[model samples]
Target: MRGLSVTETCFAIPGDIDSPTGGYGYDRRLLTMLPSFGVNVRHLELPGTYPAPSQGDLAATVDTLNSAPPNSTLLIDGLAYGAMPSSVIEKINRRIIALVHHPLALETGLSERRRAELEASERAALALADKVVVTSPATQRILEADYGVAKDRVTVALPGTDPALRATGTGTPLQLLCVGTVTPRKAYDVLIEALLPLKHLDWRVNIAGALDRDRETVAALNAQIAAAKLEDRVSLPGVVVPATLDRFYESTDLFVMPSRFEGYGMALAEAMARGLPIICSTGGAAAETVPDGAALKVPPGDVAALTKALESALTDKRLRVRLADASWEHGRSLPTWNETARRVAAAILDIPT
Candidate 1:
C-alpha cells in the first residue's frame, strides 16, 4: 500500500509548541512515532485568533496545499478552518479532514459577541471540510446535534498516550499532581477550594502549567490558596520540561483534573499511563477519557464532591490500589502512535483523493 501523507494546520511536528492559553500541547513524540507506520505528518502553524482569513493568510495556505504531492491528505485542526479562505478550501487538491478538539464557540465563559463569531466561523469550517475527525463519542454527538454534521462524515479517532509516563516510585506525602494551563475552564479554583476541606490530610498538590488566558480566575485561585493557608500544601510550580514532567509523574500518587470542560484530557491520559489514580469532572469528553474504577468522576464545579474524592484517595489505601490496577489496565489498552498512524492511513485510503 502507498504510504499516507498528512498535514495539520497548527502546531506542526518537532516544534516548540507551548501555549499559555489553556490550549492543548502537541509534542515531538508524535512526530517521532507516527512515521514508523509509514505515515508522513506535517504541522502548519497559524495565527492564534480569528476574524476570518485575511487574503495573505489564505494565499499562504493555498501555496502550501498546491505544493503538496497529489493524493496526499490534509487535516485542519480546529480553528484553522475558520482562519483559512473558503476559496482555499474549495480548491485544495488533496482530501480534507478536520479535527474538532471541541466546538470553539462553546469554550467556557466567552462573551456573547465572541461566542457568536466563533460559532459562525466553526459552521463555515464544518461546511467546507470533506470529513471531520473527533476524539470522543460525546464530541460526535455534539457535532451531530449542534453543528448538524452528518454522522457518516465524522470519524472518531481516539488520541494516544505517551509511553514515557510510566510509574517509577512510591513515597510519602502522597504527591497529587494537576497539569494544564491555569484557566477558568480548568476550574483550578474548585480544586483549591476542595483542598481546603482536606487540610488535615498529609497530601501535597503540584499544579504545573503556564498562567494564561484567565487572569482573573488565576488571581482568584491564588487568593483562595492563601486564604485557606494552603501555600505549603499546594504548590504552583508553573511549566516544567518533559524530563521534569516525567519526574513529577514518578513521584505522583494521584492525578486530578477538575475541568469544567475538556475536548480530550491529554494530561489525564498521561497521568493514567504513569499509573497515577485520577479524579476528573464528568464534563465534555472526560467521561470517555477516564475508564470506570480507574478514575473518580465528579460533577463539574462541585468543591465538596472534589474534596470528598481527594480525601478518600488520600486515606483509603485499598482505593488507591484499586485505582492503580485499573489505571494500568486502561493505560495498557490505549492505542500507541503506530496504531494511530495505521488508523490515519486507513482513513486516507477510504478517501477518494
Candidate 2:
C-alpha cells in the first residue's frame, strides 16, 4: 500500500459483464477502474451455470483456475467461488481472494435442502480463500460470524455510483421505476401487491431488469398484474441499455426496490445518485445504503406496510419533494468509482502474494 505498484490479478466472474444486475455491474466497473490504481486486472468469464454448477461447468472452472499466471492473485466472484468444491478451492496455487456480494444461501425461494447445501459449500469454499472481500459491512459480518472467516481476513469494498442528472418530477401520472432482476429475491410480488391498492392513483411503473432469468417469476408477475387489472400502468422493459436506463433515472419521480435482501443495494445507490425519492425494504444492506429520512423504508415481505408507504409517496407531493431533496443531498456524498477502485486496489495489495 505504500507505492502504487502494479499487481497482476485474475478476476473470474459469471456469465456476461453486460448483464443488467448489481453484481455484474460491480464487477465490470471495478475491472474498468482498477487499471487507474495500478492494478492489472484480467477478466475470466466463468460458465453461466454458477452457484449450482453442473459437472461440466465445474470441470471448465477448474481448467480456468489452473491456467492463471504463477504468482498472480485469483479474485473469484463469490457466485462461482462459493459453489466450487473445496478440493478445487484448496488446490488453487496462488493467493485467492473471494469477492462476495452476498451468500447464495440467503436467496429467497430456495428449498431448505438447497439452502443448507449452499450454506455448507459456501462456508467450505470461503475457508479456502486466502482472504475475503465483501461489498458491504453486513456481508462482512455474515462471513465472520456465520461462515467462520476470521475478522482480520475480511475487507469491505463498497460499490460506487456514477453521477447522474437530477431526476425531474413527472407531472400527472407519477413515474415509478424499480431496477433489478425479476427474481424472487427482488420481491416483485410484494411490490405488485403494494401497488394493487393504489390502482386508482395516477402512477405508471416501469420495472427494468432481465425477465428471462426467471421465467416462472415473470409469468407469475404477468398473471398478477393481469389479475390486478394493472397491465396498462405497469410495464416490464427487460434489460434496458445504459442510455435507456439513464433516461429512466432522469425521468422517474420515484425509484423503488422491494428486494427481500441485498449485500449492498447498488440499485438503491444508483437511484440516490440520480436524486430520486425512494421506497425500498430494509432487507439487508439497503438500510446501510440509504441514509435515514432520505427514503421511506419498510420491513421486507410486509405488503401492508409497503402499501402504506406507497400511498404516502404517491399522494403527498411535499413529502416526495422532501425525500427527493434528502436523496440528492445524500447522493452528492456517495463515493465515486475512483474511491471504489482505490479501496479495492488497496485490499488487493494488502493480500499476501
Candidate 3:
C-alpha cells in the first residue's frame, strides 16, 4: 500500500461505509482488496443525503472530490455521482471513474418526473467520466442502450461471493430468507402478500435488512404483516451481523428475492455460495444474475407468480435439492474478491496520465 508504483485512487462514497447493504459492501471490498493489486485507495466520505442531496451537500461533495491528490483517480459511487448537478460535475479536476451499481432512475417508487430527472442527471455525469465500471453485463447493456455510454468506455466487474459450506436446511419448518435493505425497491410488501395464503404451510420468513433507510416502507410492511395475521410467521430482524447472516443462510431452506430490480444480485450470489435453493424475480439484472437451474424465476411484482414458486419449492423437496445442487456448482464458480479488486484496479490504472 505504501509503494510508489501503486495508483493513488480515492473512493467517493456517500452514507455509512459500514452499512449492511450490497453496494456499500462492494465499495468496502474494493477499498481493502484493491491495494493487494498495486492500487492504493483513499476513502472520500461524502454526505449521506444522496440521490437527493441539498445544494450545500453538493458543494461539499465536489470539494471532497477535488481534494484528492492531484494525480489521484476519483472513483465516485453512482448514488451521489448520478444525482449531482451537471454544473457541479463540471468543477471536478481529478481523473474520474464512475461506479454505477445501477441507474438511480430504476429504483422503485420514483415518480415519472423524478425518474426522468434522475435519468438525465446520471446520463450527464456518466458522459463526463474517464471510465465507467458496472457490476454486471445486464447493467452494461442498460448503460449502452439507455444511458448512451459507449460500449468500449465501460468495464464490467462482477461482485465476488465468499466460499461457504453447503447449507443444511431445517425441515421441521421451512425457513425462507431475503437479505437486502427494506426499501420499496425490494418489494417486501409484495412478498408479504405472496406469503399470505400459504399460512397453513409449515414455514417461517426472515426479511433481514436495514429498516432505517426507509421508515415509511418498514412501517407499511409491518402493518401489512400484522393485518394479514403473520406477526408470528414473519420476522423483520433489521440488519444482522455478518456471522448471524451466515447462520441465516446456513439454516435457510429456500432463499427468496422478490426485488423489483437489481443491478446485480449479491444476496442471490451469497445464497448460492451456501448452496441454497432460490426463488427470485426476473427484475432488472436478476433474471440474468441467477441461473435458471439454481432458482425458480418469477416476474418482479407478480405476487401470484412468487406465491406459486414459493409453494412449489416448499412442497417439493426434490426440486429444492436439484436447485441447490446446481447452486453449489454455480456458487463455487462465482468470482472472488481479489478478482473484483484486480478489475477495479485495472480500470483505475487505465486513467490517463
Candidate 2, residues 1-353, lDDT tens digits: the string is 11223357999998887887888888998889888887899998899899878989888888898788867888899999999998777666778889999999999999999999999999998888877889999999888889999988888888888888788967678999999899999999999999987888999999999999899999999999999999999999998999998888888988888999999999888998878899999998898899877899999999999999999999999999999999999999998878777888877888432
Q: For model 3, name the residue pairs that clash.
A: none
lDDT ranking of the models: 3, 2, 1
Best by lDDT: 3
TM-score of each: 0.84, 0.96, 0.97
**Which residue window of length 10 is worst by lDDT in model 1?**
7-16
lDDT of 1 by residue, 310-348 (tens): 888889888988898899778887766555545544554
What are the per-residue Cα lDDT tens digits for candidate 3 across 233-273? Answer: 89999999989998999899999999999999999999999
Model 2, 305: alpha-carbon shift in Å? Answer: 0.1
What is the alpha-carbon RMSD of candidate 1 to the true structure?
A: 4.2
State in Å the error of residue 169, model 2. 1.8
